[model samples]
Target: MKGSSKTHLRIVFTLGIIVLSIYESSSQFLNDEFCGNKEVLTLDYRKKPWKGKNQFLLDYLKKIDYKDNIDSVRFRIPVKFWIYRNDDGSGGVTDERVKVFMDSLNHFHKLNNTGFRFYIREIESVNKTKRLNLGYFVEAPLQTIFNHTKACVNIYVCDFIKKKANGATYVVRGTYNIVTKSVMLQRNTSSTGLTHEIGHYFGLLHPHRNYKSGKNKQESVSRTRAYKGSLKKGLICERNGDGLADTPAEPRLNFLVDNNCNFSGQALTDNWGDHYQSETNNIMSYPTHYKCRNNFTLSQKSVMLYKASENKYAKYWNTKDSANKIYHFDIHEPDNTVKMASIIKSNEKQNHTFHKIFTTGKKGLATDKTDWLKFELNTENTSNILIKFTPDKIVNDEITITIYDEDNKLIKTINTSKQIASSQIQLKTLKSGWYFIEINKKQSVSKKLYNYSVELIIE
Candidate 1:
């Protein structure tokens, strides 16, 4: 009997291994093929205090006229709010609460000049229905509603249940690529913690830990200490608790109020907005008071703008198939500076005019030109191209235009030796495919090039 039992056990173990192997293989295949290669950019530091010294955050805010910009764009796009409620009768978000949340978001838009509008849709009794359970099954219905809507931003809320024993939250938030049809979010939870999580959806990382602004409080004490935190050991801070650098690090004991707490010493405090000495009134912190949780700093604003202008959100403004198709191209500089330009192509085939949509720096300077450039066209037939170059003003300097096929082959080159400042040329006929257009100056002198636009017409 013992020998028979041992043989049976061995057979069961072999079958279990086979099942596990199949499951893993299937999971990998889905992740690679179904989910496109979308990456979430991470912020630099996560455990320092926000003494209001993060530079990356600051620079981002400075680039835009927030008040005017957001207001201008608000009416142009619709924002959708998804409210998930607990069906178990514990407590669901009230309509008043929803109104308050919507108000806060709208206020934020007005303050930042986001120029976006919001529309709320509440999904009640989610907890009662197993079909709506987050992660796998729930995504299907939610995606259906998302596909039909014309909103630029989709906001989802859930009463996240965190398992106390495992310390894992049940809620997840993410942005889905409608093109690739994928979902992405920073983390998941059930609390009314919509603000921070929604910020992540917009591509904003935690403020305190970005490359420009993360540092220790002691570093500001002296210039020497400034460089000290830049090194290895000094990098550690107490707020390391929440993993956000803007929130100063505090040991476990500091979470509770202690009358004996020393506010003046090197010891960190538990109070809100205490800088290196304690936690700040920042909403990014764990403080329970709502008053302390207001406002995204200038740096935070800039990061959001940059992400909105560059990443997944960028598609909102310049969607794949809009009446006017705008394509964004990045120019990488040797000094690590990036320049952006926008191109617009028409849907109809005509005389094909190329226009200068947008450019950074001086309009006429050659040195300010970008090394890398890309263009977006309306039609898929990328062949038979015509380019027109018109400078801002008449000049004797020569301009060179190069055309390349999809394979990077130099198909045609037009060099003008005459003093003509504006001209147009037709390149060798192209097949029904995509191509690249590169523009540069012929002279070596550092001169500013002005308003030059390209117009493409396909026959």
Candidate 2:
């Protein structure tokens, strides 16, 4: 800690990033649940973000007309993760989830050019001990639960174990502790949750922090203290909404998206009558649906880059590396999937079973994460086709089925959540030349095992 921040950063390139050698290329994304979807988005914004007009360290230096006695280049940011389990060292999180989480993140971080790369230092295991019984700590832990290192960002992954308090039960999806720079998450958290929490670590805020938790008011806890400025708020971020110009003052959330990845509705005004628009692609906003969320606005990126230039990552700030080493672990993506997706043909018994795993690829393209199947109606008269999902323990809780006519116009979307054994959809009216069916899982496919049979019975 005594060496020149610049010199030390420059020297660490030889140390290299140390992590488990196992790599995965495929990943899974969580479905968006809440309009402010069930995937909870929370951050510790007590520490003001670095992008205020008067807030950046560079601003202060420029205020006094300072010169460059110091170099300001950020190297790869380092992040360390912690996995929590029972006292006996059980229930550690899986690498599958970790790979999907990190790989998907690295994909975005690399694409966005947030001006900094990231390296996972290590994933340490913290078992519950006598002094610390971390059985269930969500809203806040008793005393900063585990030992934390001074450098590198720390994230804690634990179970969804928390007690009801203040007439509420905290599910504990994600929380960032400003005091320790530690992020806590439920072991089964999704990309949206993980990304949102990390956004807080880098100094991003929710666009609608001023008002409208909507039906989620109880969970909103306390309202944001940022200046609730009216429409066309000033660029001064600290005192204004979410502190970014590109992001609109959203009333709440309407995370719905069309095939083009654009918001499905018009700008919704807040109670303040502030002209608020939707941010379906924003990493900072809580989307109403899943897989549609991607990318940070240009201004948000600048703000994060500035925030990353802070004192915490002194080791990485001044260092220069010839290569940006990102992790590529083994992915469980669907096989035989083409850019146009795979086809589902009926077998000898006229039964169709899909084997490939479904995913909404990066950029969350319209057909990105969906599995496509082509069906032809042999009979001249209209056929009554019954499409059903036969129970397989491995299949996800919810399977979304979309039907498209030969011309590629959407006919209908079947969003089914509950069916232990079988869920069927009868296409009563269909004069098909060659129709298409799309199937995708809306939740966790942690096991990567997909087993479902589709049978089209003509009546």
Alpha-carbon RMSD, each predicted model: 19.8, 18.4
TM-score for each candidate, following the candidate numbering? 0.38, 0.49
Candidate 1 per-residue lDDT, tens place, 184-303, comes to 322232122455444554544332332112343222211122223344443233222223234444322223323433323345422332434543333333233334445554445554
Which candidate leads the pack in TM-score? 2
Best by lDDT: 2
lDDT of each: 0.39, 0.50
Native-to-model Cα distance after best TM-score fit, residue 253 in candidate 1, in Å: 11
